[model samples]
Target: MNFVKRAGMSLRARKSRTAALLGIFVVICALLLGGFLLRSAAEGREAAAQRAIGVDVTVRKKGMSAADAGRLGALDVVHRYNPRFPVRAGADGFAALTSRRPAPGGARAGGGGPLAVVGVRDAGLLLPFSYGSTGITSGRGITPADAGRHVAMVEERLAAENGLKVGDTLRVRSTAGTRTVPVEIVGIFADPTRDPTGAAPPHELPGNVLYVPVRTARQLGSPGTTGEAVYRVGSPDQAERLHAAADTLLGAGSFDFRVNDKAYRDQVRPIQRVGAFASLIVLVIAVAGALVLGLLVMSQIRERRDELGVLLSLGERKWKLVGQHAVEVAALALPAVAVAAVAGQLAGPAAGAALPGGGSQHRRAAAADGVDATVPPPDPRVEPADVARVAGVGLGISLVATVVPGIGILRLHPRSILADTE
Candidate 1:
């Protein structure tokens, strides 16, 4: 029989040893596959987290204008921006919510208690809207396209108080009463905050606020200016470009640009740790797996000394004897790798679950980014390339295991083997 055939027959005849070897290889491949899947998932989650909560650079100055915001927003380093100009305005057709506690110093509020008009290029870019603390209950938010339009997004409670809905128009007068701004309602949002205690003014009440286009606020006595310009950038490093650009545009010492990466840091750090741990697992498993297989192969070779002597004495080439053992080990590796690939789908989730923290913080951070997520993040999954990687590693381990033991026994002659058998 050919050496390959003899190896197959030998494996078939020794069913228990073959099963044991198959089990060992299966375990090794499974562990390696799990590590690869985990690492890939961690990297993917980290990228998503970064996108969700990227760095924000806030620009504030003594007197900033929308024109300044436009120039800075056009920079390549800036992703999105909102220039806020919150000003007080008197409204018709609705009552602004006021605290029952008397107005501070008892100076009566004018025009049914004036409401705050927050002028912005985009309403959704506001911090309250970005965080889940406030959400649009109906219609859509004011976008950049609504910059010069007279559109407004009111609080849901204020909308309910006036029975107002989208498409309804409200008449607003400037605090100075010099300009009258007509705005059509576009959205209604839900806010959890209520009027505070201790004689707060009506305009200071949480519900007595509406979002309008910057042009509307400008028309209603606002300066079309902002203390801070909210900017979204991909990374903290990208903020440096924004800083230099702002310094050139607004002039150094005229404005301050501060980068806030708290959300990105909070969410991405844990995933990075998990990714590092996964790499460690792959390295340790690969090294320890080779060592274990080498020892096992050596023990099996020692037990088969008599068989080896007979094969050598019967005119079998010494290299064939070594090749037979190599073939047996190699055959076990293929099936073991195939089994691990199939089993990886079932095992991947458990491995991901074993990760510390388990995505609760990630979910909360995503929620704060305006996503009302109901389900948890996806679990780790084995990819096709991961199977290929584990297969290659398993084969390499088999080669090391077989070649080392075969070389050791091949150095001894058949006469020495028979002498040992006696």
Candidate 2:
């Protein structure tokens, strides 16, 4: 019989051994499927986080030390800055005044409340972008033109609660000193979560925040120190090198900073642990499965010592015998790998659905500043289509797993089988 026919016959004759080897191949394919899915999911989550933060790096004071925070503002790469101050309620503090129309009998108006204030030197840099849900909800954003105009931008919530609107005037008193400034509400916005990091989001109809130019904020005696140094890199990969260079130039611990790279920070220790553990486990599993498969195939070869002897005596070359066995294993293992890959793909969506806030019916509009601390929606990470691509890769791994053992079969000299005289 020809080499092809001989290979087919060998596969058919050793049903039990072939089945055992196929089982091992199945396990290896499964490991690859799981690892790829998790890896894709993690990448998606980090991408979402970066989008929300807007900038690639953030430098803040390590603690509540405003002095240290201000020092960061002096860095060469520092592009923007904000200084926070306290806004309180009193004669010179934040005050709300209500007006009662002219009545023959009486009229009344008043305002008072504790308030939190943030001071900014560069309003343009403070809100680099306009971030809001459904576009600008009210008046225009804060600008340098309003620097000394005593103008303020108020979120929708703050406006409604205080019965204030665009063109309305309110008082902001300084907590440190008895200084009050009357500022007009130039704009109303809608971000419930307003992050001090940057422009706040306007997801909710009314945001609970307010803004004023740096000049007006400083007048309130809440002049905070400068600010931490910050940077915006082009890509995540660039973050690491840039951070290292920055440290070299700025000096370690001189300023507090944050970079988006997965390495360098201990905060991502859990994710690192998971990835490291997964890699180690996958490696061990792959090798163990391959060994089990090799053993089964080797055992089958031993059992067919007599059959192999006859084939060798008939002038069959060593490569021909090795090729025949390899083809048989490929036929079984390749299909198993394909099936596993498809299954993994299909299962990915279901897994994503199980993630936290996954498939949430309510879409929360994110602010430009608030970081996306949660993982990204899982479906985008590993779609069903990815399964086919991964399966193809798994097939290559499976092929290598199977073919490697066949080398031993090739090394066997025909003389050895004939020496047995079977």
Candidate 3:
């Protein structure tokens, strides 16, 4: 009789053991399928979060402090924070970007309007920088980490006029000449925005603009005095939270907490975190599944020593004995794979949302920033590829569990096996 046919008969004879192993295989396969489905849903949620990051809000208060800005930025709902402090400063060495012709009324003497130096925590979070209307031509823009540092991003045309490059130093003095701050040029940006009427002040020229750290700007004229605090939040819900926080911190009826529902393109950091977690689930289940099946198969091989000896004594080849065992495992694994595919399809939606950054998390990303509507969670459909992946992992687990243990028993002589059963 063919080993394949014989293996089928043997499984029927040991119905209890065969049913137990089949149940275990089905569980392992189901988890593998669930992991793949969850990962797909996470990717969809991340895409939605990217689209949702543009909702913005600005809180304007008189004499807002740096401490207040820092505390507001620390909120999880705030995606990006920019505290703007615009001040006029006198340039020491470099020439400001000026018009060939003076103002129509002829500019007043004494160079009253100094260069415009704006202080910020994250320059990139500002309007011009975030929208690409203004872009860094060289080096990197100032980030939140540059707080308290004397780093700055010089305007492109202004840097070229002074023959300045990154790592060069520029000097700025307060309008009252009470204090001077020396700033290191870490980046140079270009802006096409110009005074259409050419009637703007010298300091207000687009080319003469300078971006410095928030702390550095505080030293120019006002200590801890910011013009306004702007934030990029994922939803209107987050914007409301910011409004409440600002009222508690800056007091009520004094500040203008305005929320702009317009979408602003920014970074989606939480999506990356969600993907990492899905990968961890896949890895943990795969490793544990292999270990469990291996131990069970090894124990079964030891108990079947008498059956193995009879097969070998009847002229069945040692390799065929191993093949029969492999056939039995494959028979169970194939059915389990089918069962898992069905189970995953039925349970995918509920399970996907249950994952981190999935269900209620989707609500934060669902609406059009301010539009209150319930958006359905990303579909975690069990695709053909996902089934294929689970199938491959199941076969791999079976190979390791059966082949490794079978090889160990196959090495013993048939006489040694028969004598052991006696």
TM-score, cand. 3 vs. native = 0.56
Stronger candidate by TM-score (1 vs 2) = 1
Candidate 3 residue spans exceeding 4 A from truth:
1-36, 39-55, 109-113, 260-422
Q: What is the lDDT of residue 332 in candidate 3?
A: 90
Model 3 misses residue 241 by how many Å? 2.0
Please, what are the lDDT tens digits per residue for candidate 3 over residues 1-422? 79999989989999999999899999989988888787777777655654445466788888887788879988988878898988788888777776666777785535434588898888766767655467788999899889879988988888888899999998888767788889999999999886546555677678788889877877876655776878877776678888888788888888888776643221234555666777788888888877887788888878888888888888889888778877888789889989999999998887666654444544454332332223345778888998999888888888777788888766967898898775
The positional error of residue 58 in candidate 3, measured at the CA in angstroms, is 2.1
Alpha-carbon TM-score of each model against the true structure: 0.76, 0.56, 0.56
lDDT of 2 at 370: 25
Candidate 1 TM-score, true structure as reference? 0.76
> All candidates' lDDT scores?
0.81, 0.54, 0.77
> On a 0 to 100 scale, what is the lDDT of residue 195 in model 1?
66
Residue 367's lDDT in candidate 3? 38
Please tell me which predicted candidate would have the highest TM-score against the true structure.
Answer: 1
Error of 1 at 278 (Å): 1.9
